[model samples]
Target: MAILDIFVNFIQVSMPRSNVIILTDPASQFSMEKSSTTVLPIQGDYSRGNLMLQRIMSYITFLEQRLKEHPERLKCINHYIFTDSDIALVGNLGQIFEKYHDFHLALTFRNNKDQPLNSGFIAVRGTSDGILRAKAFLQEVLEVYSTKYMKASRMLGDQLALAWVVKSHLTFATKKFSRPEAFSGDINGKLVLFLPCLIYNWTPPEGAGQFHGMPLDVQVVHFKGSRKRLMLESWNLFNSTSNLSDMLCLILGSGRTKYDF
Candidate 1:
């Protein structure tokens, strides 16, 4: 869980203006009181490829219900995001939202054709239509999973399902990912934007070294697969912590759990 400490450090330093919501199962090992972010207990199996869809649907539903209950809250927020815990924010996320203010749903893409998109990082504008479009698009992904990917969706996790929807429904205006511009598109009638993984969802390269690090411009580092240790490594490389024990105090808030994943 030291990685979580590092995660919190990054947020507190780089994106202090942002809020984090951590959805966990009953068996999670994170301590809510020790954590600086909101730790929400969710009812579901935390395994991949389950009917819970890795709680993607649950998060979206939670936001939907919250806004329905407090309609005015929507006008006050600028952007809302959903991301996996295995990530570290390194750049100012607000800058991206400020520049691409028109997008309803923003997703990140990888180089692989088989798995072109990674669903770990998702950004939704806070505008009424933006939220509505995100809900509509994500809900449609559920339908697409059942109708298109079927068993494969469960086996490969939600990324496959999400990619299926993007390919089958959206029409892209630009395809280049290294142009410093978004791969803007339209899904049905809603606006969608695709950001390169190198910029927003960076993962380790095949032959990356122990000291490997991302480019200075990368907004986030997604510690996908078994690279969670790299998060702590990178954090230490960038920031000097004199008292490791004291710094670990600013962790995910109050309760204990059975497992870390």
Candidate 2:
């Protein structure tokens, strides 16, 4: 099976039973409207391959309407939004949410300094304040890009806009956002929480196992680059054996799953 097929199956099977919504393009072949899982339709102009920004905006708009309609059911609940490319390695989502429950918004960091925040995986509490802030952030990003000063690039898309929003609103001076337990200090008005990249959004170089060593605590593996074949090979190798050592050996021995970035 294709890597994307595997990814979809993983999401469909392992998704938490909470109110989970999968946002997809209107033209997509996959659509599920059921009790636990709801596949919402989103339409956007494909400009320079930056349709992700439009899809994200559509999701936020949908959430805003839902919040207006069902205010009581969404109270204090956690809403996790992930891209289609992200794969779930661990199944205990409640534990992860409990670990970062103090913050209104939780985002994973990209592997490098160039793209510090990866909007691919975002978790937001269902509180009124949390939803409001998240909606404001997304709206402001779109507004900024629409203005004359900022020109949106196809290479980065929503990632650049998100970074600008966080930097403009939040303060990262103290170690509060970086360390989970150090959140006792006053945030000085910042509502965003930065999760450890290794645990939440393990990427190529570190997650490939042979390169930087895959830590035992990796919860999600994000395949950001364009190489789908290698990602599938890696996923298959990781799931082929029960022993971690054997898995690593099988992955390293094949030499076909080497990640480029």
Candidate 3:
């Protein structure tokens, strides 16, 4: 099997029992039988911008409708949103959620960009207030997507929408936990917390040879931009040798010997 195939298999085998939902094209070959995981197949010829916008809209809409149909099911559950391409390298996500129990939404910053937040990976609490804020956030994004003025700007779709929300509504606050910075604000008289980027959604620097080490507590590694290949190669090497240091060396393209381990 190919290296990426091996990496994908490892992720499937090791994924936690949390509610993992994936949004992808219907024809994708990725499959999982976990009872806690749900794969929502998307069908459309949308542009990259439109596809992300629709994915967020669809997921929020599904959550809203499900809660409406069964209010009791909303008890004691948290909703996590991730793009299909993201990977969980290490850490139990349930623990991460527990650590940030007070936060309503958790998101990370984009690497090598001026954008303060990335919509690819997010965590949302299950409270009624959290759900309402998420719905409002999605609605604001939809409006931006629908408008020609904002859509014509450099950032479109989810990123632009999230940027707008952070600028206008979300307020930054310092938390005493591992990730000190968080965004907190009120929505319709309810307090909502948006956790810092380093807590949940961490991305490696962009570029082939730029290999600054990841934070020790990064829960999710978003292989955004052109670094997917590097991440796959590192994963393949790590699986074979089980040496994280070597994997880091390979990912960074440092002069360290790949066979040293």
Candidate 4:
């Protein structure tokens, strides 16, 4: 349960508060530990076009507040991991944490040649030298890309801001720094090495139901989009496959998923 922060969008959805379904159900098993699991109820003014921008701003604000509350924990860890609620713990997470100890940033996947940047999952060591470099890069993004500062700058999005910053400033000293098993091949060009993901990816030439009766080879199947149905679908597929445990543990720790509250 070595975690830094928790952010959820449950509070903002327009539904009955009492009946509101949350993604928290999946993580009920891991909540009892002494991890710093802070659940963030969603903010009211966040809109789709600027949701990412607002979240980043909120993250910075929350980090500052936490520092004010617990000044001693500032240097305890380098960076914090921001995980999407839909993500699951398929195996032990120690391997990913180890990289955070060694590098300034980490993610389960790498950038492709054309779009060599995937910001879905990131580990940011706040104390590392990379932070200084990223500061300048982030500043450029704030000044140029953010609608708050620059109006005419139409870019792919804010995630790219982080991706371009990291890809430009950070250096991988070893092969182990990257998550080699996260993704196998090109989105539509190469054959994925492990389980063929129908959830996280929707690249063409192969899609959901692409391999109707074929066995899956991936370790963890990340349901990056359309989460609720994706998880159910993955679970159905997982139950049918006997060789999934070994593959899943590569990403999520072998322990069961848990929740705090």
Each candidate: RMSD to true structure? Answer: 7.0, 4.4, 5.2, 12.0
What order do you get sorting by TM-score, best first? 1, 2, 3, 4
Q: Could you give candidate 4's per-residue lDDT for residues 1-261 as a string of tens digits?
A: 211111122112111121111222222333332232234443433555565565455544444444454546655544454445444434333344453244433444332443344434444445534343334333544543464322322334655554444344444412322433443221112121211122222221224333333224222334443333444444445546634453243223212222122
Candidate 3, residues 27-70: lDDT per residue as tens digits? Answer: 67576555555666666434554566666667666556646855
Better candidate number, 1 or 2, judged by TM-score? 1
Clashing pairs in 2: none
lDDT comparison, 2 vs 3, better candidate? 2
Measured with C-alpha atoms, the lDDT of residue 4 in candidate 2 is 51
Candidate numbers, best lDDT first, in rank order: 1, 2, 3, 4
lDDT of candidates 1 onward, in order: 0.68, 0.58, 0.56, 0.37
Model 1 agreement with the true structure over 185-235: per-residue lDDT tens digits: 888887888888878987654332333444556778777655665566556
lDDT by residue (133-246, candidate 2, tens digit) is: 766656776765555223455556577766666655555622343443322112334366676667776554524454655556666666656445555765576556535455
Query: What TM-score number comes out for model 2?
Result: 0.75
Off by over 4 Å in 4: 1-37, 41-45, 75-79, 108-114, 126-144, 147-156, 167-220, 226-228, 235-261
Q: Which regions in candidate 2 have their CA more than 4 angstroms from the true location?
A: 12-20, 32-36, 75-78, 148-152, 171-190, 206-210, 234-261
The regions of model 3 sitting more than 4 angstroms off are 1-15, 25-37, 42-49, 76-78, 110-114, 148-155, 170-180, 187-192, 206-211, 242-249, 252-261
**What is candidate 2's local distance difference test score?**
0.58
Given candidate 4, what's the lDDT at residue 104? Answer: 39
By lDDT, the better pick of 2 and 4 is 2
Native-to-model Cα distance after best TM-score fit, residue 201 in candidate 1, in Å: 0.8
